[model samples]
Target: MYDQATIGARLRMLRKWRKLSLVELADLAGMSKSYLSMAERGERALDRRSYIAALADALQVSETELVGGPHLTKDPVQAAPHATIPQIRTALIANTLTAPLADQARPLPELLADMDRLDHSKYKFREAGRLLPAIIDELHVHAADPADEAEHRLALECLIEAFQMATFTTKDLGYGDLAHIAAMRAGEAAAILGDPINRGKADSLRIHTMPATTWRVRLTAAEQAVERLQPHVKDDTGVHVLGMLTLAASMAATVAADASRARHWLDHAAELAGRTADAPGDNWGAFSTTNVNVWRISLAVEQGEGGGVLELARNVEERRLAERRGRHTAFLTDVGRGLARDPRARERAVEWLHRAENVAPHKFRNDAKARETVGVLLQQVRSTTAGRVLRGMAARMGLPH
Candidate 1:
């Protein structure tokens, strides 16, 4: 099948050309009208080849016409010195830095705070990558023989957090293998030096890594993750882990196209979010009421409820969400996708995509759908200042320029 992002634009364009109502096309394709409508928009990725064949047949078009087109860049970017996962792989595999870590001399707490700077920054991986190996090395060496019990605990915590950050960064860029390695390392570290709470948090983080796995597999894993975390929800730490696990499960359910199952997880998450309002969050994300609402918008985007997404987006204060850079980047990406299907709001779609790129360069560049959205827009939006800017943005993103 063609990339879903390009499929939407082509479908929208061809449907208009054929003067076919969505109802007519959905009936012809034997799909629900809402699903056909979502496919015409960019929110629901048409992952199955069957959908492509059915739609092409109904439209009286060749499958290739619907599936293979120039508006999409089908291949991943070749290895660049600054390529996404390679740089991270290099960071994890080797440290080009000749000098050993002076971090060895730095207090673990101080070094951790420094690393936090990198974790929070958007796609600033090279700087973080350069620093991570040294930090990891120093932490590993220190943890091998702690001065005392308290020191051993701190050292273990540092390693767990480090591995957790590594897992998240790698996974977000679509590198599942590396993410699982890091996540497993985190779990291993936690298992050796953690209480029940720490183990639950580690489980939640590892479970969150499964999104890049197949949808069915990830959904199954999500169910297991929630069941495991459920019994631990008796304390503040338990509350945070439960919130994260439910969020992960809800997200997986959404991708699995099980709306009721997704809502069941979301309701569980909402309850956890309400309880965790006063609880602190670590790298997984803040799970407050507002955060739950933000995730609700995300789920709506996954379901291709563009109108509802926009409505929910309006209700949440952007600045507060924006402060959480990762989720803000996601929110903007979803906003851009939802808006691209609205002819009246198509201009704003470009604007929102640009905003998302600005917030997290890697999110747009590494994501095929985001790149396709820009590519399709570049093909469509000509003869305007906004169009020119979008063209520049797409070119910089390494679209077929």
Candidate 2:
């Protein structure tokens, strides 16, 4: 019985359940038979978006089914975020601009202030999930019935911010349906608000929230978004938003295996990042030199370029990323996952993952890639400390150790 709870295990089970030979599945997924065998045996990591998407398509399953998401933890603290998804979904689906679910609404400024606080939390998924539903309900009330045009604009801005946060919260917890709805809500609000930068922000969120299975379509949309935002890139916020969109395009390119296009998009983003300050904690997307490097490391990992990842990490401004919990943890997590593929670097991988967990345990524990990396490293455990750390992470994630 394959009960290891890893993607490779799931792949093997699904393949056998469908009565397909290893070579058959590989042929369906457009991969070599030997590569598919290695992936099924857990000798290779299925960490790339393209591979997972391809396998899921071949298996006639959703990507989430293959990835085994909406993970639940035995720890009450870690499971708290998952509990909030239901309310968020209800709030998003059941409420309309003219009709809100909540009875009383708070002032616009107060709600906006709350949104700002949540933004500065730096991807504390639990906190955002816990507080966003009520704020979203209230913000919709204000947007539905405002005093004046100025008040309505403020309400739309806050609503867009809240929707973006909701998208992040739900997306991380594997609630893809709610995430898509939240992103659409943001884009609608941005259109009404008629702010080009906010529209660009909403567009970037849409790109990120788009399903990886549609990499070709997403790549085209990202390219169009970058062009749309080009003339509006007259300020730092515009630059940040545009840079994020460019990065999104690069990610899609990477998933599609268009290395040349991905590098071109990344280089353009790097140039844009240089024009702005490294504001990792900004309400806008954290588009800075450090953030660019973080994306570079993650993209390199997706492409299975372990050596290139570290070389790219050399340019990450550690001091700037110190208190930016989201970007900091992301950088560490990708680096750890990137290095986990190398037998000699297993211990270093554990150390990097541990640092990331310390910075943001909630975010780190919920990360699907981080969980897969831990599972893969656990299978090859050697060093006592590394094994211990991997086991601890597995326990926290409610996975068998």
Ten contiguous residues with the weakest lDDT in model 1: 72-81
- Model 2 residue runs over 4 Å out of place are 1-4
Q: Which ten residues in a row have the lowest lDDT in candidate 2?
A: 1-10
lDDT of 1 by residue, 152-190 (tens): 777777777777767766655546567777777778778
* Model 2 lDDT per residue over 80-190, tens place: 788888889988887777787877798887887887777776555667878888998998888888899898888888887788778888887777878989999889889
Best by lDDT: 2
Clashes of 1: 0
What Cα-based lDDT does every candidate model obtain?
Answer: 0.65, 0.83
Model 2 scores a TM of: 0.95
Top of the candidates by TM-score: 2
State TM-scores per candidate: 0.73, 0.95
